[model samples]
Target chain A: MKRSFYLKIFLFVVLLFSSALADAAEVYYLGGPQGSSQEAAVNPSYSLKQRFQDLFSSLSSIRKDPEASGSISGHLSQTVVHNDIGGNREKSYLKPGVNYITDLNFSIQEKLHADYNFTGQWFLRKTDDPRVESRRDVRLKQVDLQVANERNLYQFGDFYGSFSQFVLGSSLEGFNMDINPTDDQHYQIVIARRNEADTVANSFQRNVFGFKADRYLFKGSDLFSDFRIGVQAASSQDDSASLPDNHTAKDLRNTVFGLDGEIVFKQGLSIQYEYAGSAYVEDEDASEKTTTYANAFRFQPSMRLGKANVRYLYYYAQPKFYTDAGSSMSDKIQNQVSLDYRFSDRVNVTVSENYYWDHLKGSSRTKRTFNDEKYMTWNLLPLASRRSFNLRPYVNYQVRNSDDPGNSAESTTLTGGFDISDRLNAHTNWGVGYECRSFIDRVTRSNSEIFHRIRFNWAQDMMLWARRLYYAITPNVDIRHRKGNDNKDVTVGAGFNVQYDLFQRVFLRMGNTLADTNSASPSGDYVNNRGFWEVDFLVDKERSAHFIIRGERNNYTAENGAQSYKEQRVIAKFEVNF
Target chain B: MRTKTIIAVLLTSMIVVGCRAVTGAVVDRRAVAQESLFSLAGTLIKDLFDNYQDFSMESFRAKVAVDFVSSRNDLVNNAASNIRAAKVLDIDFSLDQVLSDKDLLMVDLKWQKRTRPYDSSNVVLTEGFTQAVFKNVAGQWLLYQINKDNPF
Candidate 1:
């Protein structure tokens, strides 16, 4: 009985959203002057006749100089896939099935008057697959209708609404409007549904309403090239009526108010700041409800000094601060700074530091943890230079500490890597890289580990018999050593890939990889091989077909036991676009 | 188990029917072939720019991989902010080089953009060089990553 109630609510919401489509249809029908004469005769009203004649005259004018443009384009595709697994039913990864899919996109733009225009867009998709649930068979992904002029714009249906990072930023489906009455002033308002009710997930539908206003100044001043200030407000709530009886999520209500500003100077310096306060209630419909009021703020500044660029950031958020439509890291205070300096055209360096901590309220029962990270990068030659030789090296170090009575544990980690590439010629290139990482437990020295890795890559391009061919090979090795057990493990792997134009209309691509691992632990010792081959045939610009085959095998030899498994798959697909 | 068996039989029969239809069809030998891989990769980049200029978020979303990774770790928010910021007045790009490895392609390019902020009348010009990675997902090339900087 409860299920039926939820279903009714869901249907009602669907119908409510569908009203946008219905309105669009009505507009088109009423404007086309193609309505049946029988309706006019039945009405027999003078006003109806006069309206019909007016529409006819308007249609005649449109036919003379339409100033209208539209397009319809998309693709239809069919695919068949088969998968076979051996020795490991639990390891089956891919779903095997046949699928038929269709995608259609249409849009129309017409100039309604001197400085106004009407635009409409529709996107639809259909997928048929017996292996999947039926609920995903067809979907109307996005639809939008807009009426805009030089000073104002209004949108109905789906749109992405954003105000500020900490106030409201999310994709919504409903109505949105932007009013720009002058060059220095702007206003925006949005009312939309954030999420639809999900029966499988047992989650209630969510809705949001928001508005923002901005004022700009000092647009041409030398000291301040641009300065802007804005204020924003947003409220979001979950529909308790749409919640299923067995729902697993709490009904939430949240509202946020924010203020933000930005300043840009003529000397290549800029600063931005934002602050938001939120009031939230969880399980609003329940007797025992939880409520909280909190605030969050962020400040960022960047400057260019000589040949160096510097940037700094500071952020803080209370533990209970929450915004349903925005992003924030709660219960933490963070500070970060970075510098990028160019010594010369061929050399550059970057350095940065970050520090953050949680448990800002200082709860007695909870431990407060702090983290610090430092990083640096130096480049001998930039990658985009495409020089004969390019070298890049970087290092990172981190420290974590906690303040607790009996468990005051601390740890530190250091990591470093370097990459060097050489271009032998226009058609050939080779690169090599190495990395090392070490972790230490300051309180317990026994709990420590060190890891090292090395990799090499080579690529070549050629034209053989007037056909283009390209291939690449990469090999890598990794070693991990632990202090407690005095155990060391190593893994070695190599991969090769090749692409060739077999014919004017056909292309072939294939790749294979092999890996072997020797470990102190029995379960980790294994040898693996994987490969795939693909062929693509192009019938024309709008038609194509693809066939692919893949296979993988794994063998494990350890003191405990020996095991093996194999998997294979084949896929064929054809697609046409119109 | 009964449903699985029925679905298997239906799929097999459909495959058989499809094969017969394909065998009966005729091929057109004079039709134009697809463009080269290099040209195709370049065209994909151009299409990305056009979509951004036109503010076509749906088309832009279609060109991105489902498993896309970003250095900033916030693709959705970053994309939304970019889309809401300004209107592109002019754009110029050059594909400096391309590297192909089976199902993956790496492209290096330099681009310049001129944009007017939504609330201001002044135009801002910015230029940079970046590398982008594309992966072949079901015969469609989708953007996987932007190594250094993301213009959009």
Candidate 2:
């Protein structure tokens, strides 16, 4: 009777959000630990893998009732890893021990309008280590209740915000607002302790208050239409004053302010810009005040000319230009131009150029410049429609100058490759292709390299399983002359990959790569290379059960210690959903 | 030096414009606020990848105050000021996921950027995810915000 009552209650909750697909409340913020067993301790923010686990758990809960709205899911997964980084075979006791991980997620969302939600996770895992320390842990990954309406969003417990690029997007306990009083503008406000989500309290979990406002200007004007301008300000106080980084709470505070905008012309031209400035509170005993600034800018123009579309772009970013939430676009400037033309029936061409400069922040180091060129595959594609075989050929070239940013060294490379495939019967096909590349580098002058590769692949589709196999062979030579030294090196390699399925429930995948290098020199020269082989067998049944056995080997050889290794690993995993 | 560089660029642009005029193929395109959400979202990405101006690179960002963000253009120029020309590498614009409701459209995008540094000849690959949100305004969709949720 108790079991039936619980089931009925679950059904009632699911019925509440049955119509969620049509006009669902947004999940603007879902914050928790985002890391793997290998990365969780060091990563302060929740991980992507964790999010997927949470989603699957929610899905399981939804399966109970078609109209179910609550979030509760059970999960079980295990992985074991063995590694040996030391080269000594006799030291059996020193071999790395196995590592294991398992977790469970329970999430709930209760919404009459689903304008609000209560969701969290209970995660447990264990790590094995013979030398250092093993960890057996259980923690609340997150427990947060969220409420949202047309103009407001509120969350308690654990949450994060995505307000602006310069603003901290850190996980914390906070109240946030996504308020829109007027149609043309909106505002976001966040007040939380950054790094508070760390399983262990961080020494610098500062309390930060941030707000941002955006105003859309000139709703429908040609030049001004769709233009968005935003301003933001944030200040953080040393919430953990007892820590060493902020003893007495004097030297550990900061203020950030920024402005960003984009103006677009209907004529396929645009200008985008961002600026961020951060001021750090200085200790009373410090000698100088420290402040940092960063910026990003881009210009793009695109057009259709005759029968082709042409685009040109230039990008620039300052080194150390830090935005707490922005992608790293620092220390480099780049330019890209491309022209893609499609001719009536027999002709198609794509041409593009890319150039970049790195090390702009170095005061004394010269900058390095790179140039890349792509001339699209001259595929006799029309023949494919009228004939049994099609040919596609392409060229790639690159020129790099200096390891240092300036005129210290240079390297140039070019390649030409092609692919042609024949359609054999209804279920089988095979293709073969080859390419050659030449490279030359002159740090102090005198280096030459040439390489060639051949690739072939076959595939067949029949019964309930599809099978495919691909292989490639590559050979290369390199010669270097410096002052009184001369060295010659040659390398040969091959690779194979295969995939097959049996009974529609079992899958097999495998790949192998082998390479060898030979070097001769009067002064001193060494060659190094790596060979790898991996295979996996998976059994998946009706998406309910999954099992996989995987093994991998990495063998490395080198005359010099620059690179050398030999390692092997095997893994078995099983997963099921109820 | 900066002034000279700017002047040189302007001169080069004029020459290019003159050539386009001679061809009589220079067409005008405009994206006002009348576009739908999908069109508007696509334009935001297009503007971001195509614009070459330092300031134009910021065109896709919301036009509101974003405290302490270094202007993307300035950052680029600072990184490679001597570089007067550039070209984008293999970048694929894929809208991997989309969610929409009455007044909002949220999109998960995968942007693959392959490029050589302004002064180097080696390519660097920075692939990441960005979440973009669009809001409906007066029967038109406009980009409201962008967050870089890149996988580190």
Candidate 3:
């Protein structure tokens, strides 16, 4: 009788929550790295993050004053987390947290003549484990300051620079200056010490120094039509504790010279080209030395019609094109052609094809393992108003072909999806979507795959106080046919998530997902389930308090093998914004 | 053995470097928009050179500084936001026209932009047959308007 009485109270509390909805602000980003209930997974405490900003707002009247030309805004959060992962390698962790963090930007400016801006972030963090001293420290993530005007700009602190498409752009700490004596021409000088971000947890630090100069030449007169050219020379050296990597130690000194240009003959036509040559000198094993050279180049031409933009590109890079570390460019031979068009205000389409001739930096480049891909995609928007009937549709098709010397294969895929939404009233909304994908291969066309998915979403607001509710559910069906047999494999999945604002600043959220797979051949069968429950309470607009619990389970049985895996975790979080 | 070891190290380094490039691309896509906040003049240049991205129509329309023209020009704002990022640092530019006044100035420039990451070199070399009108507001120069110009 006593147990039954307690159950009645529990049921009553659940029934009360059935009428609530989650605060959209706290749950806007649901699918980031840590999955749902982000507060419990990534940041255990951010509600207190608001206190720092509140304290400073009063102190720095300059920050809040409307008359001031500059404004500063940022968020600070502190978290404590306890996590456990259950499986073959079971483990648990306890963290005490970051002492403080600041993502702040401050800027001051004068009239049209000049302005300066500074932005940076800092964090102080530590763990509860006393045995690991290295797990605790204060880290500075970013700091950049710039002063600029109409013709020239100077920058100091942390910044990235690149010359041409491939060479340069290593994150560094230093100074850069741009001089523009004329409107058509400019010169740039860069000097910096490469400050690698990964050095925070690693045993080795690379102290590389870099310097480069770039000159740009162009003419804008109709007599000359269109023209552009860029020339650059850069040098860098690795001046670090050259510790042995893979039982081999080497120090590198590299230099690169590059030139790139473009010319437009008419309104719709243009051509572009780029080339960079890199020379490397490596000193290894005390007295041994080796030298190598690499070259990179690209050529592209494009045309624009009334509704379409078309372009063709060819790129080539040798294995050793990168000196120390490159930012954007890669070592490969590639060719591509693409077109984009807008059929109407509500519809757009894009078609593209890409071919990769070789991966020069891979295990083998001379093997001639070539691959190509073609793609077409369309997007449409048919919505009349934010609260009226709305429709959105998307479709995509792609094909990939590969020739790896003696072996050849091809794959084709097509997918389409659409969402329809309607407003039932002033305070309620409903939406539904359906999507499907079909996949097939050329060599063994018998092995094919198809997938279908459907989802429903809704939100409601109650007139009583500031309360809201949101819910969504999705179901997926997948089928894959066997190549040699008439049998096939099938899997089905369904998941739902709900959020409720129980009070003025408190919320409750819960979600569950489950999937099952069955095979006619009896060699592949499995079931997977995952779920999470959470409660978040807001102290203010920028401060929140939260707790969460999560669990997952997977079981598989087949003629080839049988296995099971399961895990559970709990978290508490706080946040503050200033 | 030495040659093999060298090859392994080189391969590993390349993998790490390659991964960083792709990762940075993803990071840029996911970065908070606050860092790239709007400025009357910088917004246009920001869309052309530095980590270029489309701005909301409201922001573009409101930022249009030309008091004589319609600030809510959806076509201009849309076209401005649609400008693609340069593929490389290759740029050609020339100042073809400029009209100067005490409170306002109009200029016409032309150039070709390539596909590449944000860099000062590109900024210094960017080209397009662009018509930009600047106006002085409280002693600050703001991007007043932009118009299309014939390239040839």
Q: Best-fitting candidate, measured by TM-score? A: 1
* DockQ values of all predictions: 0.02, 0.03, 0.02
- For model 2, residues A1-578, the per-residue Cα lDDT tens digits are 53464345334423432222111112111121111112211112335565445545656432543133443544455666566554433212225546554433333443223233333323333435322123455434434455443333455554445555555544455565554433344556677765442324444455777766566556668665467666665666655443554333344566666566666666655555545555555442356756555455555556666778777766666664554433335677778777878785456676767677767764234556555444444646556465657776767666767555445657665656676777777777777766555656666344454544455556665554244433333332222222333443333444555555543555666766554444443222222223333343334343355666777665544454333345566666665443
Candidate 1 residue spans exceeding 4 A from truth: A1-68, A96-123, A128-136, A144-153, A244-249, A288-290, A362-365, A382-386, A406-409, A443-447, A542-564, B1-152
Greater TM-score among 2 and 3 belongs to: 3
Q: What tens digits encode model 2's per-residue C-alpha lDDT throughout B16-118? A: 3222211111111111111133345667565545432112111222231121122222333232221122112224454433434345555556665543232
- For each candidate in turn, the interface RMSD (Å) is 26.2, 23.9, 28.2
lDDT of 3 at A306: 91
lDDT (CA) per prediction: 0.63, 0.47, 0.47
| Greater-lDDT candidate between 1 and 3 | 1
TM for candidate 3 is: 0.57
What class would a CAPRI assessor give candidate 1's docking? Answer: incorrect
Q: Report the backbone clash tally of model 2.
A: 98
Put down candidate 1 lDDT per residue, A354-422, tens digits, no spaces.
788888883333888888878787878765556678887878787889887654658887777787889
Docking verdict class for candidate 2: incorrect
Given candidate 1, what's the lDDT at residue A102?
49
Per residue, candidate 3 scores C-alpha lDDT tens digits across A1-578 of 53464345434433432221121112223322111221221111223345344434533442354323333544444444344444422111212232222223323321111122222322223434332223445434344555443334456765445455445544456776553322233345567765342333332334444333222233444533566665555666654463335423345577666666777765778888877777777653356676667788888888899999998877787877754534223456777787889998766777767667555664244455455555555555556354376665555455555556534556666656666777889777777766565666676776555545455656665544556777766565544444555654555667787788888767788887665656545444555566778887676653222333333232222233323334454555554444
- Clashes per candidate, residues 3 or more apart or on different chains: 0, 98, 35
Least accurate stretch of 10 residues (summed lDDT) in model 1 chain A? A35-44
